[model samples]
Target: MDRIRIGLVGIGKIARDQHLPALNQGGDFDLAATASRNGRVDGVEAHETVDALIAARPDIAAISLCTPPAGRFEQAMAAIAAGRHVMLEKPPAATVSEAEALAEAARAKGVTLFATWHSREAAEVDAARGWLADKAIRAVRIMWREDIRQWHPGQDWILAPGGFGVFDPGINALSIATRILPDPLVVLSAELAIPENRACPIAATIAMRCGTAPVAVDFDFLQTGDQTWDIEVDTDAGTLYLRNGGSRLELPGAEPMQGPNAEYPRLYARFAELIRNGESDVDLRPLRLVADAFLTGQPTPAPAFEF
Candidate 1:
């Protein structure tokens, strides 16, 4: 089969670090063009905007949108309307309603639409799910802490109203939790700690319930020591620990299992498969949990944060 010509929009950190490398390594996709205001990819035609890229590169069959969630809807809609398959970064859109709109547009145009959740494809996620398939889940705890200034730098969109704030990384945990847990869950309580200087929250504490099972998620940006992205589960069988953002898994008596670090590669492979099979993989459960936390969670003022 001929390689799918792909265009990339929003050449930010993720685009350079993950998307570009992944697409370059994947055999099913060829990076044909890119769109960005201040970033560019070597050896590819670059445009000032996604619209220009779409208009200029007619051969591009798919467009991977790496822009922040705030302005994802319009760009995604345009790509779908132009008959290009779309692969959206996590949190799909600024709002749940916008994501729904994009889904509708993709269906109307009969094109493949993939809402990419890189964390969901983490090496140990599937293993965690498999292990928990028959075991009774008693509780889940997540601790996702990182230095935003070191990670995001001057990216201002992450602090915007629809930027998702701490939920940006928090949603990844939610994605893994929702996928691995045996039963359906819903947000029971939440506390958002918004930086006084920013429009989005910098920290959040969320409590979720899956029937009788309870889950707690904590997202913090003040960690100065060894950055942590870990999830623990207390089950009737034993304790399960997923560390390094699902890269490694450890159960009661077993040693830590290491897995491949190819989330983006796997994502592109899935996208290619979806395109070839004429299917859409648009799961909104993770995004829904974030929205629920925003809608019903209490807001708390937090110390000023600088980047």
Candidate 2:
């Protein structure tokens, strides 16, 4: 089959690091064009805006948006309006309503809309989910911590009002939890540690529930030393652990399962399948859980953070 020509927007760090490499690998997609304000891929058509890319490359069948969540709704809507399949990065949009509207618009335009959670497509997430399917979950602990300076660099928007802050990475944990666990999760309470100089939290502690099991979450964006992105679950059968952001899994009676992180590749493959099958996959459970935490979280002041 001929590869589908696709345009990518927001050529930032993630685009350069993950999306470009994944798209370049053998897949159902060809990186036909890119739209970005300050970044570009060598030997590829580049445009300054999504509208320009769409106008210039009318044959591009799909558009993948890796832009920041704050202003992604407009770009996605524009792509959907042009009858192009759209794939969104995690969190989908800055707000739930915006994501919902994009989904509705895509459906109305009869194009595929895929809201991708890259972590949920990690090497062992499905295995973790399968193991917990028949077992009784007792408790879940999510500890996701990373240094913003190392990962995000000078991205000040991360601490801005619509940036999502620590939840940006924390939601990855929730995505895996919501996928692997059998029942829905509800946010009970959250303690958001906001930097004195920022609008969003630098760290957070959340209490949640899933089928009567307590789910505790700790999210930190200023963590130094070894970074942690792990989820542990206590079950009637035994304990299940997902390490390296779902790239590895450890179960009670089985040997450890480890694999290279192939999340973006899987995501692109899934996006292609969705477009070919005339389907849309937009799971909002993780986003909703974050929203609920914000709705009920109590804010506390922390020391000013600077990158």
Candidate 3:
């Protein structure tokens, strides 16, 4: 099959770090063009807007959007309307309604739409899922904390109302959790700690319930040491731990499981498959959980944060 000609919409940190590397490794796609206000990938035709890129690069078959959620809906719709497949970064859109609209539009246009969840592709996630398939889950806990300054320096969109704040990384944990858990879950209670000077929360404590199993998720941006991205589950058989964001899995009387670091590469491969198969992969479960937390969760004022 001929390689797909691809364009990148947002060339921010994630696009540069994860998406570009993944696309290069996939080898099924050619980086035909890119559109960004301030960032650009080497050797690719650059445009300041998606519209211009689409208008100029008629050979492009798909576009990957890596922008913030605030303005993603329009860009995605435009791309789909122009007869191109779209791969959206996590938190598909600012609101569920917008994401639904994008899905519907993609259906009408007969193009593939992928809501990419890189964490779900982590090395140990599939192994952990296989182990937990038969175990009776009693409870689940997720502790994800990191310093914003170190991870997201100078990224103002994260602090904006639609930016999702700590839920940015928090959504990653949710993605892995929803993928591994055996039962459907919903948010029961939540407390968001918003920094006094920002519109979004810097920390959040969420309580979720799935059938009889209770789950607790803690996301914070104030950690100083040993950043944690770990999920633990207590089952009737034994305790299961997925540390390092599903990169490492541990169980009683079992050696740790590890795999190749090719999340982006794998994602692009899946995208190619979906495009060839004429199907769409749009899982809103993870983003739905985050929106529910924002809508139904309680709010707590936190100390001012400066980065």
Measured by TM-score, the strongest candidate is 2
Our model 2 lands, by Cα RMSD against the true structure, at 0.8
Best-to-worst lDDT order: 2, 3, 1
Q: Is candidate 1 or candidate 2 better by lDDT?
A: 2
Q: What is the clash count for each candidate, in the order shown?
A: 0, 0, 0
* lDDT top scorer: 2
| Candidate 3 lDDT over residue span 192-276, tens digit each | 9998899999999999986699999999988877899999999998999999888999998888887777788878999999999
Give the runs in model 2 whose Cα sits over 4 Å from its true position.
none
Q: On residues 1-307, what C-alpha lDDT tens digit does candidate 1 reach at each position?
A: 9899999999999998899889878679999999999998888899999999999989999999999988889999999999999999998899888988898889999999999899989999999999999998899899999888877888778988898898888888888888998898799889999888899889899999876988888998767779889999999999999999999999888988989898999999999999999899989999999989988889999988777
Candidate 3, poorest ten consecutive residues by summed lDDT: 257-266
For residues 28-116, write the lDDT of model 2, one tens digit per residue.
Answer: 99999999999999999999999999999999999999999999999999999999999998889999999999989988999999999
**Residue 33, model 2: Cα distance from true site in angstroms:** 0.8
* Candidate 2 residue-wise lDDT at 72: 93
Clashing pairs in 1: none
